[model samples]
Target: MLFSSSSTSLSSEVSQVLSENIPSRSTTLTGDSTQFQINEDLGTEDLTNGLPKKLIQLKKLKNGGTTIKKAKTDLEYCYDSLRLYENPYVATSRDKKSGYSIELCLDNKYKTLMFCDLQLNTDFPVYYDSSLENVAENIERENVTPLQIRGKIRIHIDRDDQALLITSQSISLKCFTKEYACFVDSGTGENTSSSKIIKELNNTEFFESSSYPKQQLKVTHHSSSDQKILLARGTYDYPFTFTLQANTFPATFSSFFGKTHFRIESSTSIMRIPSKPKGFLKFSKNENITDKIILTEEIKVKRVLPSTNMLKFEMFQLRSYNAASDVVVSVIGNSKLIEIGIPFQMILSIVKKDPSVELHDASLAVAQRMAIPSIDLKTMDILPEPYIKKSEYLLRTVESQSFDSDKTVYGFCFDDVIIPNYADGLPSWFKTFYFEASSFYPNYAALKVTHLLLFRINYSKNEVIEGLEVRKTYRVTVNFPVFVGDSDISTSSLLPKYEKFENISDLQDEPPLYSTVTVEGDN
Candidate 1:
């Protein structure tokens, strides 16, 4: 009986296995037990041949699932991580001629990294005409050209990756002009008529060219680094030499309606991953791609005046006092303006009606008015330093008198008076304040240094009683405006004229002859 039961179970299991193995045209169960139908158009070859058909189907599934793994990894490069020590760097014509320096840095960690190739691409505007006004019209007519200057630097990484190998780099500047013709049409076709009246209109045209001729200036490398320098993983500094030329203008300018712009761009060809070979058995080329990491910053070229040319001088009167007798005080020097750490000269002249009146003493005082204290807690309640509380003189001087009997003029001259460098303290209600630029006050128009001249007169008692003596004492004050700038002053002379005669007739060999003739007529 046990054998009989076992036989029945075995028979049922065999029947189920056969049903699963056989390919069904209508429906089939997947490994997840999801049922789906097969397309009748695919044909029923597997349905007729059961076991072999199942083997074929499994082989096809295995082949479809197979994938070939990539052999070479993709190299990653990031331009956004690049940093420049100076951006929008300015290089004047003098600077460019003398050469300039720039610093750059890169932050990256990669094992398969190679060398970096740095390139500087410069573009300078070249106009056909010297006039800037016609630049728009010339541009619209496609008459403007661009002059290019290129420079390069290569950096190779060491095997240990500790430092980079650099080559000497240089910047070369060249200026040139281009000529082109522009045509403009002025006639309007709105007045076309059937009975055509052909009228010739006047046409006007002019030729234009650069004011200065073509010129070239070269600046050598001034970098301390050798031809092959080993730079570390940090910032790399490069210096270049520049030479100034006669025709050189400011680095960037707009003139005659046209503009000349100068720009420097840095680019690198490195940090790119090599591509794998075509076939499975093939290897990667390991060759560096031309792909480059271009920096976003573009350095600007400009021009700056030398320190010697920065100083300027001008003459302006301070004040005049009219009393019992006219007393005029004027300051004479290289300039009325004063700066810190610079010495200047000043002269005080006093004239009086009575030559007999002797000069006792004379002094010059510099002072400013104190600002009103605000209702703030810190300032209004507490008293501050002596310098803050009172409007004291920043500088004071007593001058000796020199009487000129011939001119009846008493004069005092002070030389090399230096302005002390003082900290510009904070503003409060009780302290005098000066702004970096200019400051305005409500009641008092503006804040400035006040110069006071105190003079004492020694006169006879009888002379004092006379109206000629304006007063026992005289005070003449003036507002002295000060500025901070260069001390050196620059002057220019007109170009000398040369004698030239295009024709002998224009030279006038001798003065024209004049003769007098009288005509008598009978009345």
Candidate 2:
């Protein structure tokens, strides 16, 4: 038998059934003995009228309560028949201009004949009216407004236990201009017609502004059936989508102060089992789900004190004493204590002793190195085995500025150097090794784990070869200690212990601040 009804009548019937069956308050079941009443109006109708009966079962329990059971002959059902098996059932984005897509799957037992009317609704409460009446009117109009749209499509589905891809619909937000005005009530005044405009925020002007996007879906199932018989199907599209809108704040204060919510609703037509025509039956169910679409990304900011003494390092005479040119390198910055996601600057200066030396093709690099330990098996002893250092470049420069011609000073400045958020690895630790200070001094053992900053410089020198000027290569390497602790370490904790001074000049009168230093021969 063919079953059909108007959209308004079907909506009313569904609403009635939902209101009657759904409990208003929570109830607990104790004993099994119980009995409940099922809606008799939902029973199957006579086939002569071309209408099938909707069978509903109510089983009695020992706890004196009743539970609703599925009808033995009910084949037609609403969206409750479908299930969601994918994550992000609702896609989200931060950019206001971005769009999103959704995927849905059908139950294995039912096959869809066709989808009637597919509607897409975008609601932005902050920018447009989101009242129930307005929403209903918008859906009925089926116009493409800045916040909502209703799509028309005709698609057939026969797959089971597979996804029904709906890739055509994409949701996005747009900017528009709105006018705001302030009015005063003219109750007992001279010109008491209604109200008078006192002031206006925008002076009736159009100002473009953007808002968040909240998308919803509505689909109509034409025909769906299982192995036994076909379920209820008709021409009019059913309301398959749930209420979805952008979040709002307290009306007492702010009107738009919350994240936008995107909703995805999947539903199936009400099903009726083929049974002896004795009573009427009606059933409608749907699933409503929502997710938040972030409008902006969050950033964390932190502040830290600056440390001077322990963070500075300088290396004098980086090359051999008898080299053609001498280079002195110095780095000034807070290295012992560093915070992730904070910007800081470091100063690097290089001074050449001889003014006559001309350097070309100069480059400098600073890298963080990791030292791994190893043991010697032949001697059955632990030896100072520093593995091949793995380096991560922190700063690099191919250009430098010269300060003076008399004593050439080249400086490279690293500005706004930021430690990445994911650099919180293992902390520095000390390793023990036996070393002799000199031939005359006695041997001693020392334990230390040092964070070394490798400074490298490469340049070319002008030389005469075979009665012609030639460019010869020259290189220099310098190592400086950089005490790197955890990213959360504070600068004040690494500073030397001394009394606070009232002013910069008074700091000289106070005891000098110093940190312990361990000196060992080069390995």
Candidate 3:
């Protein structure tokens, strides 16, 4: 009776269980019938508990995290989830200088999940990470946990001439996505292949949160009530956990962006103590006053790809034409989809190569291909709008080992080992956020994102086709119009419905309210 009879397959299971307990003509629903039959098809046990099998299956999934479950997820707003200031996060920055870092240690099936903004995509009722807690129906909890900011700091004391104390902490998250532009500059042009953030997408801050004073700083149950802490000479470790307002704020369309970034900006108010050292130490003449220091660390967030018009993955196969010999290339991966933050692995095979060619280096890159279809007014002809294309690479090596002549051995690149034929596991992380973050973005916009997997075989050929070929360098190019995003696993299928939808102009022209906030300044 909990779930009224719906078209779901559970109706059939309930029917079979019901027939065994009551007569065919009996309208009353009860187990007190004078007559009952137990057969092999209906099971040997008598009816004791009236719970259906569907509820039992859900009970098991609740204990373990299940992403993209069948049930409709209910959003439950939560705040100040944890106060973790004791555990030290894994220290990074191989350099000797003291610094800080953080990692998203998740308990879900996948280490990294996607996050969408509420304002960007207004179509569907998208759920937040908080829903994974206990908001979803039946299952009282999420398939995984969220947010553990683990970090450490070190300092050296030469007789404690001056003191440093931390009085407070805070964090912020930012989002910046754009479509097309020209003749513009905003500081990101150089690194992004001359691409600049459109004036419309410029955001001061998407989300800001600061630690509350009532909550314990170092420990939750300490007898003393002081929240401030003093940094003694040597090295000490610490961690902080924060809660994000995942829902209620503006969510995003399923599109993805490299510029969209989430990071922890700890706002700390520091005070210097005026003290004379025991020996030859020096101190500043200025009196001690509380100043501020801002520390930043990169964190990853992605929207949950529900079981709807889910993302797709496929085998990448192609052939490059050469009059001398045809170059056949096929790349395979363990999983169906290519997700970000995971090492990408592909089995690449090539055949019928020109004998004089020497394979030197190869790389896989995420190319966000863009073009606009339009009509020429003067010519009265159709032509694709010209959008200059470019690609970027950070040096990654492909380790090779002896194998059958037909196939090659490739492993991930670690140190500066020579890379001949083999490729390291997939370098599928964001490629500076260029991969297919969503279903090629914007289901309703002409400005859309298309992905291309460019596998270039860098080699040197002895024989030259042209008379003036001085360099003798050649490239066997293989291109795959590949797909790399989550696919649906639902019983039937559902379209991603947008609860709210905004066009380019409306979103850009909208006014944003401002409030007062404390910021740091240089002396």
Candidate 4:
């Protein structure tokens, strides 16, 4: 008998199934005058299985390829856990002329990733086309689907030169709620005065466009085509409206009942601007972006500010490097991925820190927004911190300068992105590094450091022609410290306080460790 006096019909059915399935019969029963009764136990009652099944599915997903769901991730978990030749994954840069190689390592721990000493052969021809004729690049693999993870370790090759590059890829891991966002523009030109256009008590750093706090206008339709452009002659006034919804916190706090569980309610509002406001966004097809004239205007804040909440705003700009037509529009989100306009193969780079630069810790120095050029949505790259080692986070994309023989000339720039400092402000260990690279090591090159926030490099045209004639490669390295402020409500600094007593015997019944330990010696 498998049933006890308290057994229900459903339990009896399941018990009968289990009894028939097992090869050997083992039952807890006692004979009765009318029937047999089974003993009840809670341990044998649970029929749910979730853990083992998940592992089995993960194994089945692997199909003779570099499995993304393997026990370990291809990207290192921290900065210190990096390797090159010794590890299963290695990154190498090879010279086209001398056939020499340079090895770069990815450190997962310490947030510090770097390449060892790099020495390139001067005879190889360098390709300067931004189209990537022949340069060794790193691929990022962090978060992906089981199918994508189990697929082959894919490497992209330039059809012209057969040079291989690893693409950058990653996804958001944090949980965030999104809503219908409208009239979102980074603070730029006249958009700066439009803060009153949004009436919510809270403002996000990411506008509909630029991700830079200082940048304000979202450049929507930029055409290099020879079209009649709107010149920046005067400030123009316009009308705009926006609707917003915010997440609400619990009105009451009850720590005794549910310590960890808390619920939040959501509220929404609509804002309309009745007055004509002045702002500027110049439209000229001829002038390069740097030389374009800029106009500024101010708008009035309509809503009242509450003393409790802080209002923060940010702006960003996106442009295309290769084709004149392709443009990328991005908004910074509370989560990992920047809200990009397109969905396609992307080459991503996370601008973190330069380990080679001077600093206590280089990676933490630039935890601000990064500048990204407009790109086709169909062929985009997604790079985040988790996809690579901490040191690699600082690596970003740059437009190649020119192609001389097989050598490629590249131009690199850092964004003027900034994050707000907390009350405890910038940690002592934080630092930031600046770097500039050329086609090969050229003679008489100059680097300009401006505002402690910007950097520029000038090269002698004659020296570039002489030293960088053909296939060659070189990398410039820099480093800086990261700043972190401690917020009052920040969860990073909370711990329980415990008291220590002098005597063990005076206390109540002691634990084994307390009785066994003595100041002088323990036998």
Candidate 5:
């Protein structure tokens, strides 16, 4: 849910917090079964009693098969939601436009957004404690100014539908989220598993993890100046705008158990007004037709946090024994951003050597930790701590490598290693490796995933502290936090640079102390 700038000084401010809740759906369709017969498309099926089925077919036909043809829109999107900072295509399936209907367009297109970068300066702050101001304060719902999104909609009524009139239009940014602890079966079609929660929670029994609506902006309405004009319309164009109060809208993800999402909805109501009999009471009452065109567009939101650890030239070092002397390990890349399909460098050098110390086989690996933050059952807000699940993958290993404290000045750089993108399937693996665009996105309130680069040093040393000489074997580890993001969006001007080094004593900076970094862990 949060990210830090590299150093302690930079990360002192607040961090990003996930928005509270997102609804399962933006709009629901409901109606009474009034048997009627009609034909528009789909080979003329019965017009009554099959509303849901009818809508599905209409959506495919109207939106051209559930996707937007790129030729029609300026926005570009990624096919998968795994990578960060790419526009995501949500539902573009529009209802069939016919008879009396309204079309709502955002920035001129009805495309749903999956990820959007929120630039935070003093303007947008991300908040962690929410007590005092911090770097995250810009995006904090309680602190920052509301963000405005504008769009235009056109209402059209057929010439024959003379009584249909545009009454009022409503626009709102709907931010809501929900979680369900079920009966352990995803297909159960049930939300909360009350029996399970009660059994698991035995401490005086307070259960059910669901949050209330965290942040919301008032619904906005735009109405035509007067209603005296003929209820029917040739065409009406009205531009509407919505302001988003919650800046940290998490990327939308839904499963049987939980959901985090955001959407914008616009509703236009139209009703048929009965006209009094004109030339002398010819006829009486007519069935008044009332309809509302509600349009919902889901959007993805992301917060970009910068860190020096990801820079190529921003070198970081970890000494085996002491901050002042002894063996050292160095990585050529920044600590923050470790990317897949890209390689980084790691080096080992004995800055100072003695016959008492010996270096053996060494290996580098990556550890992945997915932290599903704990939620308060009562408030539904995310707690500070998380329930972390971990898995490890081997990056590269060295069976034998020689390093002399006096001879190896530049240190021994290992073979480049990468985060795998091709090992796509485990349950199903093909003879050939297939590529998947799915890699863990950096941080999310609902599900936060993080990685670490681990350098495991295997060595033996002889010590004579006591009266007798003793030989000892030891495994020392050096780890670095890995933040995932696209390389194009990196804040570092250039990659880490290096200068010629002839001797160990010629190094400029003092030895590095221990580094304490964790995903969403701020100091």
Candidate 6:
């Protein structure tokens, strides 16, 4: 108050936003706490009280944990705001019931996309971009067609309650249905009505004098949680047919059911099935959070299983704030010891190497000397030899099939080198060695270098299958920098000894020419 303790506030913006009106202070209750208990307006039926209860009728055996029941009459499922979504799973030929699987993926807009049926054609390229229509249209045409007269009917619990709730407000009719003629009187030109068909085919005579009800369908939703409210309001149609017999039809009637005259059938039955809730609600026992929340917890962990006799090692390069650091590790199998080291090179001397020692045997001997559990000659080690010597590293044996050109060309392959752990401190006789391989197609100035080298041994059937059957081939490329000033003789006076291709500087903007070297082997 400009002058009293009871009230004194003045703000033009607040006054205008609040209707610029004054309240009667005389009517306020000074001590009453009712004003603080205002309920929030969530715009949906507040399930804060819990889901509407289901009336218990008859209970049957449970399938898994779900209970099944026969509706006293036809059922329907109606929602306030319904949204249909689907996700795809891998398609396999072994699925007998469904015959196929629809692969569903989410689009950028978070819409669920599914491919009903797809068949890979020979003309399909090895790689192609996938757009929504490209694959869907092609696959649907190639593998599936509309059931000229078929429809699907399903019952769903609108709310999260495991029990179905019978609510007149939410229950509605025929989400989907179809009607097909069973018989037609050609001379009379009258479509056999549902009542007529029932009379003619009542072999059991159960419906001899019964009249079906006009309200043939209804649907409802049960609240799954306080937040998962019932929503969606819409109608759907489906194709349906009554059972028939060949003898009941006249001799001239259409042979196929589709050819006969028929009217859309309308009857209501509860679409009762397993209760599944799709809403923004989760149980207390569920560990997952809303997708809108940022994930900070480690979601995945990989365990290292002990190798079954094969020698092993591991290596990694960790990134730091300032720079990248290298690490090496090795495992001594017999002793069950680990070693780590830093980058160090070893120059392997041919003099110390025994000429009689076979290459495969030599590698195994080296591994055994280091107390490695086991060594396979054909397996390639992923750890670089130099790092293992001083960096104290772990090693893992990798298969040749996993080798890539980048790994080989980027000095990723390494020889077996051993390092000791520092249980108490560094070793007393600490020394490191390094070895760098000579480049391929090398030569020396003022001299000719030996360029020929060849070696071959046993080949396995698996290798032939991978090489010849698939016709796998890879390209090897080399890039080197060149510097030149204007000169008429467009060539280096004495180019680097191994200039295998024409210099690109002369072509300016033209595409570079290439030469191929074909290797042949007699079958």
On TM-score, the leading prediction is 5
lDDT of 5 at 255: 35
lDDT of 2 by residue, 1-523 (tens): 2233222243322211112121111112111212121112212121122333332111121111111123222332111101112112222121111122112322221111111111223342111211112222332212111111222111222222111211112111111111122233436667776443322122211111111111112222321221111212211112222111221100011011111122222222222222223322322232211121111111111111233222323222222221664655566664433334454566666667654454443433334432222223233232333222334444445542344445577776667665445434322321111110111111211111224445566555567899998777666666544433323224323434435578787655554422221122211
Which stretches of candidate 6 lie above 4 Å from their native place? 1-44, 51-65, 68-410, 413-523
Q: Measured by C-alpha RMSD in angstroms, how accurate is candidate 6? A: 34.1
After superposition, candidate 4 runs with Cα above 4 Å error: 1-364, 369-462, 465-495, 503-523
- Where is model 2 more than 4 Å wrong at Cα? 1-322, 326-330, 334-340, 352-366, 378-380, 386-388, 400-407, 423-450, 465-468, 491-523
TM-score of each: 0.26, 0.27, 0.31, 0.15, 0.48, 0.14
User: Best to worst by TM-score, what's the order?
Assistant: 5, 3, 2, 1, 4, 6
Error of 6 at 433 (Å): 40
Off by over 4 Å in 3: 1-147, 152-167, 171-238, 243-258, 277-289, 302-368, 371-448, 452-480, 484-523
Cand. 2 TM to true fold: 0.27
lDDT of 1 at 399: 37
Judging by lDDT, tell me the better candidate of 3 and 4: 3
lDDT of 3 by residue, 1-523 (tens): 1112231232121121112121111011111222133112222222222322221121122112111122221211111111113111221221112122222222232222233221212242111111111112211112223323333332232333333344433322322233222222223345664332322222222211211111111211111123444443334333333333232111222222222323333333443333434221321332334443333333444433333333323233344654556344555543333433333455556553555454566666545443222323334232334322344333343322222234333333223221122245433322221222211122212222344566666555565456664446666666554333332122112332322447665553533311111112211
Error of 5 at 235 (Å): 3.5
Q: Residue-wise lDDT of candidate 1 within 247-289, one digit each (tens)?
A: 1222322222122333232322222111222421231233322
Per-residue lDDT, model 6, residue 56, is 21
- Which one is best on lDDT? 5
Evaluate residue 255 in candidate 3 and report its C-alpha lDDT on the 0 to 100 scale. Answer: 27
